[model samples]
Target: MTASPPDNSAQMASPSYRLAVFDQDFLLSDSLRGVRFLLEFAKADLALKAWGVRSTVVVFGSARVRENGDPDHARWYAAAREFAALASQRGGAFLEGGPVRDNVIATGGGPGIMEAANRGAADVGAPSVGFNITLPHEQEPNAYSTPELTFRFHYFAMRKMHLAMRANALVVFPGGFGTLDELFEILTLRQTSKSPEIPVVLFDEGYWRGIINFDEMARRGMIAQKDLDLFGFAETADGVWQELVRRGLKPHEDLESLTKSP
Candidate 1:
């Protein structure tokens, strides 16, 4: 008994003995939720910085709309795809070897509209960002988002932060609750001046008006009539681009020319 050394296996195996960073159980504990949030923020932030993503055009739309679905769904899907392609080509996303990329297409990173936007960027051979979230049902990232630019997050707040931070414009397509949530989130930020003045364009005026009575909101005095100017409507992909430009979204070429000017 005297010759037998003290057994330290249990002590060595204790959770406390594990390195803090490598301790998955501890890291995922409720107490570390804030830390997890920071991690999510830092990871995406670092990736975007490395990729030279200076500004983004966030696209919010319905995940239920399918390209081969009903007439409305098909139309929305095609429009979303076309808008992404046009934006990627004309926006700074296609500018190579630049110090920063601007107006890059950004999406929620799911099927339907998200997929269409990402696919549109891919169609023109440009990089796009997909900010996917972890839902209870596990939403998957669309296939067309640039592999290196695609990201997943567990916190909606963090995901929204990334979406808003570098946005040069916001393009909203027809969608349901989730789409409305995102659209309002940006609109509120713009109204409160929490974020920069970015163009907000909604596709399908009839659809949006049918879904919500913005005029009624203004008439009720709930929202100021001037607040109605926070967004505009577009009917087609090209019209979306034109509306964004009209609302003060500067293209990459314009930015470059300005920088070079005296």
Candidate 2:
């Protein structure tokens, strides 16, 4: 019997034909990075829209914070949890089966203060969002976040965008670089008016003051004196809620009550 000829036609077929949207190998390829970016944004956006998350109260803080143990850790963790519950209860998160959920708590979706914030919303029977990122150390989403609303992203940029896009306010806790990075990203956006004005509250005035000398920045002309007004400090969870309200975050429930008032 003669040997069969080589299947050159099959070998010459375009690789694109074998490519599938769900194929990790193809999706992670350099040529498909842009497509992956779009997919990341679209998927999160679609899920958020379907869930009726009109606006969010973003919480940023140290993932190392603990609910119990060290006094400082316990304090920060407790405050984050309380703030989340307060935001949910008073920031329009507990709507009457509506499609326009507002001020829903959003977190980094890891442990520490992120977990506390999500837990707080859960305590109030409110749906919260978790924008988790894939990290080298295998960071996992906290159980307190709404399972259906939890999202995992490989791109930090996409995660940040989702966190910032619908934010009605940002409450930051004592943290290191990651926290600072996120805080400044929004601050820069607010400074330039690239995004709408949203109140930024940094919890624990002492911690923030020690880490950053805002007044010195103003004195050195690194930032305008008015820039110092961009964010306020809150020592307690109730204080944080009050500051947010003072900065003009009207709850959906309040809107109805205000309308009914003679």
Candidate 3:
């Protein structure tokens, strides 16, 4: 693939800047592109190691939610803290249950609940990884990300690949468009048979219900009942771990031959 610019969020802001100069069957060399990609990959790899994680639970959320926000009785921060801890426990369970301990924490590497999750993981002595995007606003990688684990990417696809490649499970916290983007991508992967059948746990039951009405969709027969079975929801950290253990989550790599391949 040819090189592309960072944060291509805008169209042709610079006339001199060409996106990809493909020359026939041979793509022209973009020195900076290769360097940056390698640097990012290396950084991510290092961050993964720094935490001594054997596996990870990819957590998704907004970078804007305050530790004090509320539309209901519970604060988002409380929920996020549970998300981080629950994923870790579930990750640990997968490890002891004949699965490798890729049991580290992973995130979009941004703010909001993502930061909370990562922070909680760190508090419990597990390392966390952040696959940050090269977005225009509110997309910066959170400070809680391990120094080496932080990545700013030109390609959301690549960032996602990093998230999916080692993920044993996914815990989605409340978020906006970006969170929805990652959330749906994983769902589509499972629906289209592109991703492993790993457990997808959505945090905050009420908030989720307020945002999207999956049950109503099922009622309308827009999605089959089996399709609706693709994910689960949880309230407390312990309950999240219980669901994962009950369903039997394993590393994506171990389940590869039996799952949908990219």
Each model's C-alpha lDDT? 0.94, 0.92, 0.71
How would you encode candidate 2's per-residue C-alpha lDDT over 54-104 as one tens digit per residue?
889999999999998599999999999999998898888866776578899
Q: Which stretches of candidate 3 lie over 4 Å from their true place?
A: 1-54, 71-74, 93-100, 250-262
Each candidate: RMSD: 1.7, 3.4, 10.5
**1-262, model 3: which lDDT tens digit per residue?**
9778677646555534444443322232464556556666666666665545556778887777877666432366666766676656545623344323555688888777778878887766655777788776646777777766677777676788789877778888778898899888888888888877878888777878899999898889987778887888887766766666566676334443444556
TM-scores of all predicted structures:
0.96, 0.91, 0.72
Error of 3 at 44 (Å): 3.4
- In model 2, the worst 10-residue window by lDDT is 10-19
Candidate 1 runs further than 4 Å off:
1-5, 257-262
Model 2 spans with C-alpha error above 4 angstroms: 1-16, 254-262
Q: Which candidate tops lDDT?
A: 1
Better of 1 and 3 by TM-score: 1
Checking candidate 1 for backbone clashes, the offending pairs are: none
